[model samples]
Target: MLFVAGSTVLGGASARAAEQADETSTAESSPIIVTASPLPVRLDELAAPVLRLDREDIEASQASTLGALLADQPGLSESSFAAGASRPIIRGMDNNRVRVQENGIGAGGVSALSEDHGVPIDPLSATSVEVVRGPATLRYGSEAIGGVVNVLNDRIPSARPSGGYSVSGGTSFDTVDQGKEAHGALNVATGNIVWHADGFRRETSDYDTPQGEQFNSWTDTSGVSGGGSVLFGNGYAGANVVHYDSEYGIPAPEDPADPVHIDMRQTKVQLRGAFAFDSWLRGIDFAGGYGDYRHDEITQSGVVGSTFKNKEWEGRAEFQHGAVGPFAGAFGVQYRDRDLSAAGEGGELLAPNTTRAVAGFLYEEMSLTDALSLQMAGRVEHVKVEGTALDTATITEYDVSRDFTPLSASAGLVWNLDGGWVTSATFQAAQRAPEAPELFSKGPHEATETFEIGDASLNEETAYSAELSARREGRGYSFAASLFHVSFDDFIYKALTGETCDDDYASCTDAGGTGTELDQVRYAQQDARFYGFELEGKVALLRTDTATYGVTGQADYVRAKLDGGTNVPRIPPMRIGAGVYLEADRFMAKAGFLHAFRQNKLGPNETETGEYTDVSMAFRYTLPEQMTGGASVKISVVGQNLLDADIRNHVSFKKNDVLLPGRNFRLVASVDF
Candidate 1:
């Protein structure tokens, strides 16, 4: 039997809905810039659901990592592997299914391979973020079968400066780990040329948890970016270079006395261009990037135990066209190449690998009537994977190559109702080829503390997903809600074989345990089902000449199970929250309570997690120009887990040993000139 709750207004395009006015309001429901879709239409014009986190919300959150900043949002959860390493889990799907990209390019990091690794992209580097679901995945690729989290970086200038020159900077501090960060950006536009530069540095000490302290959870990171663009009469072209470095530690439950840490570096170069024409073809846009990344895992003795490296490049081109015979659409092509390798201890897990892929996608929309539209899209990808396949049976490695052609398609319907109300339904059938790690891994991984194994005979994974959502954009009251379900065939996942093993694979099944510290897990496939719903909205309770008071609330739930009546491991439990806010000219504040219910649904060898409530607060004030030498300045105070709750992330691999950070007070001050 299946269970689903009923709600009339549970989900919608929140980005297109009303602003809460927590830190003041948007320019009266300003149109959001949408990028996930092939067409440059408003949120309502797209069939899938989109949730955006704007600049104001980032300032209020004052979170350093991308996962920490967006974890509390509806339909989203974090792995919370450590204070420094965390990744978002969308509707119980994570890792390979979710694509975390910067300006349409992959992060080019190894974070997706393991939860203990950090996503190199920082929250401070992005001006906004979009969490897109449903048909939007067709535009990215098969890897985005779950969804796409697109980070809009400020490294490249999209528009000219306000007054020929502009500068902005900010500094933040938090008490949880005594974290401190400073960031600055400068943009100058003269004539048709625009230049941009930005840099940031962040450092944190081991964070305090409800239980004394998390011994090895701290992070030190810095990055710098510079770019320039030449504006044409109809479009613009730009290029940017970014360099990043970071060192972070994870929980050491396996070896608490001698914790392991990682040091990583990445350099990326990107080029983007857009052209508008006066023909049936409306415009052409292009994006390309090259990234060289590497990381070293160091033991407590300060010796590098393993090294991972990746050099990759990707490029995409899009062609937009106007209506033709009652239909309008866009078509595009994309190409990606990656070369990755592991050495030292990591070499036992996987050998050198290379992957190349090319895909072509197109989407078309037809207006059935004035208030209704039909959208359809399709994509076909050709992928070639080359690597050394490990034969667990023969205890030998052999070079192997495989090729696959995965296809995907989607269809959606949008209905426009009266009074700023809109609803949409989208369905997609997508397939994903086996990633390098899934098909070639073997041996013990000290970072995750798992003796992993893989099979080279794995096939493509496929899923059929659907979403239904509605939204209302209003000043006094607004709301959005969504219901989604995804069914998978041949779902590839890592599961323990109810056994333990040592560092050597031969001992894994020898009836005796050598390194009993490591759990034995293998890559396998199974039929699975997932379904979830999300609800979020805000309503004005009181309105006065000086300020407006509003009440806000949100709730989300997801459930997944295998065909054999077994629960899915690491699935987030139901969460419900509510809050109140005040918005004025110079002052704004919000207080909220978010609670996670107890989770009892257990997978094999999985433990239960207790319930917890998080009390949070945010306040912001704008200073007068006279006080800051004509520079616009804003100060914000943000608090998280104010009640100091003892919380464990159900989605985390280390949930049994690690606790979420306790009470935290964050202060942010930014200035613009």
Candidate 2:
């Protein structure tokens, strides 16, 4: 099955490649704007593969969350435990391996620690989004070793009164649930001060699955943001604050006898400010932010209550100047203080503690030529962890404190080859320290029911990666491809030893005993590597003054191997997707299909999941301009398990019963006033 699905995806990719080649033979030049840089540069001048999602694309997709929207991109996958909980997986790395940024600053808090937690930002209010793939993301930080997803919003007040408001309502056929959302913003300029304010609210009811109606898991979210800026001579300064809150849950099984239920709620607040200073020596940019996040969960049986809280503060300052001889660059120092604590209903601390990180970085981008550019960056960070641990047997407490200093660096070169083609290559060395839960937690994970044991002596994980990419943009057509290989030293993974405890409750701690425990699954410095390539392009087959038709397709393949003759776990197989789109003056339509090949090659702790295909279609219509109103209606139908194939995302952990939302349908209506 795996071989057959793989061949089908490859065949489809070949056909698309051929079509792209033909389109490029007689294409015209299309001007592509580049915003991946601090200053906007043309696409032809960039050496990296940056994927942009504009407002039009965002509206067309009509996804509820950023994670779901990114799932359409090549080389990206998402896993969700419920409608409100989803996380992105790039290449084969996720969690702490990936970074999610808001504007240009790190989205501080605890979203990176678990898969069930949802990102706080609302995508409906975003103006645009960009994904920096591969090692090129090293400029952000070592935490982005996998990649970077940056969400951009117009939180800054404009110099003129310019703003819009939107409201939407939708429902799903399977869940019989209703959803409503509203957002409003106003920006006005007066004298030297520009003021801006925005607010949004969303609410949804519990949804239904194939088995039965999932209950008690409704979502309610609300946020308000405001900012003010003042222009002083050649510099400007601004301050902004945003507060958000959400509550949701996951229902137990259909049978009332199951006796289990899970509920979660989160609240977040962020305050930030930036100041720009014009000086004779160099221009300086200073920014600082503070964030507070709290998560509370309630479970029906084994674990009555579980709660986690995280509070963080960060500050950074950078200076850049282009007049310096081949030395136009930015250097900044950053400090983050994080406090995390978790406990169960019995007052026993499951994971306790506080950690502090101080980091400094230097980044330089030099133009060797009009067609060639070089980038060099490095960061040094010191992390300190302090906590108290309880010894189960002795019933005694132990005080622990440890500090680690990790260093990371990267270099890259981009070249604009003649003939509308561009290429870039990058190499990076990165490291990640252990998270709080990984070092001090003990007991069963309420979500998975696995007994977790922490190792205080764990060391940092490190890796090196290299990537090469090329892109071509022509009239009515564009194409891009990237290849990457990453090698890891002391990669941390989780494994289950085929042993059971004497009472089947606690795992044996002695070396000679037979028991199962989830610890930093240990392994010597083993060599592991990941290689993948992605190709995506679009071509306009026919175009007229009032109408256009186009076809787009993308495919990605990834393979991972370990030196000890083992297959890497949790790696997604090859995937391919294609879509056809047609647009008129006021009407648009699109149909697309995505196929994921079966993955049967099992690692020591993995199992096989069958192949699956999903199909979706959408249509939209715009009202006439004379009415002084704009409204759109969209309907989408998705078919999962098109082949009625059974699949599972995880062998031991998640039995995700791949029911494919089973012929689900949704309709949404939006209006602007």
Candidate 3:
């Protein structure tokens, strides 16, 4: 369910209604930006399933990792490997299949390289977040065949406030991890120029679970950004710079004595511009970014075991054209270049390589009638990868190079039925080129605790997906549901060989000794199929000017298997959730229960996970007007796993050793100025 704030009860309100409320409350309310499109569109008008989380939602979720924050949402789950890092698993697909972005540009980092590496963006400072679930790959890229998560921030001022200056700050504390966080942001306008600045700091101790404290799960993060923009007639130009640093520990090393923590830092710069013209062309939008990121893994003895670096740059330009014969569309071009390197005592160059790519895309929407719409989109990209590797025993140099031209296309239709109901159907054909790591990796990786091996001969992965969805929004209730299926021609994934290896491959080849005792995994390709469905609905039980009450129900399930009949490893289990909520002019409260069913289907060397339920609640109140600042002030208390349930995520590699946080409470306070 979407969020509602202030005054009259908005129980069971849809996202469209919530957005309308914001506009009524604030004249300058911003619309949800479509990073993949030339211009922004209303959430309700889109054919695909799109989830938008604003500042309030971010504050309410306050999870240690991005995946954890969205895990409860329909068709989403977290690969809860550690408190330090977790990546979102969408429709049972993750890693290279899902794309993470910041303000429409790729987040240039090694987060996708391993589950232990965190995404560089900080949610605490984000203004909003958006998720696109179907056919977005037509515009974003084939890497996003599963989905796309875009984090949006106002580091580069886009608009001036009613007043000359605006400032806001907040603080929050979480009990489970003994975590403290503080953040502040400001925007100042002087004529046509606007300046923006923001900063945040967060620190946490080891988190406690129902069993006990999860040792070495602490984390520290801090960052700051500054930017400015100039607004001219019908256009704006802006640039921003940011620096982020973080430290966190990994608790999955086989030997408790082994060192396993990461110290990471990144510096990024971006520029954006848009212009409107009074000609056949409607508008033009452009964006570019450059990032320098690196991380060092430290052992318990203070030794730098491995260091990884990523230097990347990307740019995009799009042109919007006026409708021609009932067809409205935009065309664009994109370019990206990246270099990855690693070095250290334990560092074996998993993929010391350089990747370069350029692409062009076209998107169009047609109004078949006042109640019907059609959308078509397509993209073609040319990519090249070059890498170098050395044999462990022979010490021989090997050069690897691969090139491919991938194409993606999608078509969708939205029908507005009677009774305030709408339905959509989408079909897409997408292809993904092999990533750098999948093509050149050849050594032991500490993050995943495996003797890594890549297949340079792997073929491109091709997928055909289809989705059908329906939604209804009425005066006091809302409902939405979707069903999707995808078939892959050659899915590239790591498969366990059921063979044990020492710290290095040498142990496995030894004549008389067992190696360090780690599983050996090899990159392989196989035909696969995945299908899923998500259903959600809310109903109002009572409504009045002073108070309103509502109930919500949601369920999601996914099944994935190789063509040979073996289940996919680490797939999310079926989940169902229900909740109750109440809201008034100054107060709001909600409680919910979610249950994940036991997963019995297993792949080779995989274990089953038991079922579990999580209970959560939260209450918020608006303070009285005498708070000094000419803005609203609010306080909130939130609780998760109120029943202290022992929870284990099957999708996590460390599920056997680590449990999720338990019985945690958070105190949150914030003000708008």
Q: Which of the numbered candidates is closest to the native, going by highest lDDT?
A: 1
Ranked by TM-score from best down, the candidates are: 1, 3, 2
**What are the Cα lDDT values of the candidates?**
0.80, 0.58, 0.78
* Local lDDT at 597 for model 3: 98
Off by over 4 Å in 3: 1-29, 349-351, 389-397, 509-513
Cα lDDT of model 3 by residue, 352-395, tens digit: 78999999998888889998888888999999989865454564
- In order of appearance, the predictions have TM-scores of 0.94, 0.83, 0.94
Clashes of each: 7, 2, 4
TM-score of model 2 (CA atoms):
0.83
Stretches of candidate 2 off by over 4 Å are 1-35, 56-64, 134-136, 156-159, 163-177, 206-218, 231-235, 251-282, 300-304, 345-349, 388-397, 498-527, 629-653, 657-660, 671-673
TM-score between candidate 3 and the true structure: 0.94
- The deviation in Å at residue 409 for candidate 2 is 1.4
Model 1 / residue 335 / CA error / Å:
0.7
Clashing pairs for model 1 are: 10-481, 11-480, 11-481, 11-482, 12-480, 12-481, 502-515
Better of 1 and 3 by lDDT: 1
Clashes of 2: 2
Give residue 42's lDDT in candidate 3 (0 to 100).
Answer: 43
